[model samples]
Target: MNVDSPVFLFDQGIPGFENLRQFIFLEIEGNIPMRLMKSLEDQHISLLVVSPFFIYPEYEWELSEPVKQELLIKTEADVEVWSIVTLPAEPSQATLNLLAPLVLNRNEKVGKQLILHDSTYSSRAPLIRA
Candidate 1:
């Protein structure tokens, strides 16, 4: 997992994470295996992540051309994605942060957290990110 000093956190350590300047990109350990992406801000910690196959089982992004270009991802193999989990006051109220998601281009080790302007989405949208 240390490809050219891979910046991924799953199989790597977050050296100097307390002072890390790159807030946009990261490496995280999803519920399953270690994926890629971590939160430097308050949105999330513990590096929550999800496999596209599990969470977004029915996801088909209508991403704009600009976003696709920004990710520098010309193909499906380059995409890596994740969402945040919200600990509920009680088990019945559990939720996930689906309004904003972290999308990354593993090929380049670059990432970005985007807020879905779509009002249909819930800030505490389920991890289903559906």
Candidate 2:
């Protein structure tokens, strides 16, 4: 994941964050599996993200044809999936938004937050099993 100079350009931006189109992915220090997705347009708009597979080993999804074409994703290796993390006052109550995921094309440095409209997944799935 050599994303040193990578700038994720979201053509339509993430939902609720339409004003932000450019972002930088930065790994959170001391947290190997966590990352800081900071919007270049607004420093305050930073999202805590993590590879969903890290918490949910069975996490998987197919990118829609339109998404594949828009992101220019040709191979599976070109894509990296991440989920937004919600940290509650009680860390044990933290959750991950599984219904919507952030998919990035490592090859093209573009990304999007795709909402799974017909999926069984939940928006506030537990981040870890009890």
Candidate 3:
């Protein structure tokens, strides 16, 4: 199984998170709810992720043109989206930012993290209780 996959960012010549071109998504089991995102290039940088729907329901996402072209996403039918969250100092206080999401075209294992330009979202939106 692919345990540690490299995630990329758009930068230089990359269209979607080309700067963060490679990352590994690690899942921590035997725990209530915990996950780790370890960066392959810079091991020190990692973001905690969780199901955003837990807090925000009916979240909608849209991809950018450059990202679609860079990732080569053929159609809206080809993508799965996820959001990154901050592991708050306190587990209960942790929040998930649904406005911004990390998109993945699972067919090719290509993914990118993007922040929506509109200010209609919050970085620390709380995930609804499950």
Model 2 — TM-score against the truth? 0.93
Model 2, CA-based lDDT = 0.89
Going through the candidates in the order shown, the clash numbers are: 1, 0, 18
lDDT of each: 0.54, 0.89, 0.63
Per-residue CA lDDT of candidate 2, range 51-79, in tens?
89988898877789999999999999999
What are the clashing pairs of model 2?
none
TM-score: which candidate is best?
2
Worst lDDT window (10 residues) for model 1? 8-17
Q: Give the alpha carbon lDDT tens digit for every residue of 92-119 in model 1.
A: 5656555666676778766666667854
Per-residue CA lDDT of model 3 for 1-130, tens digit only, reads 2554445432331233345566666766775343565566666667777756544666666677888987779988877666677665677776776666777676666766667887587777875454
- Please give the ranking of all candidate structures by TM-score, highest first, separated by commas: 2, 3, 1
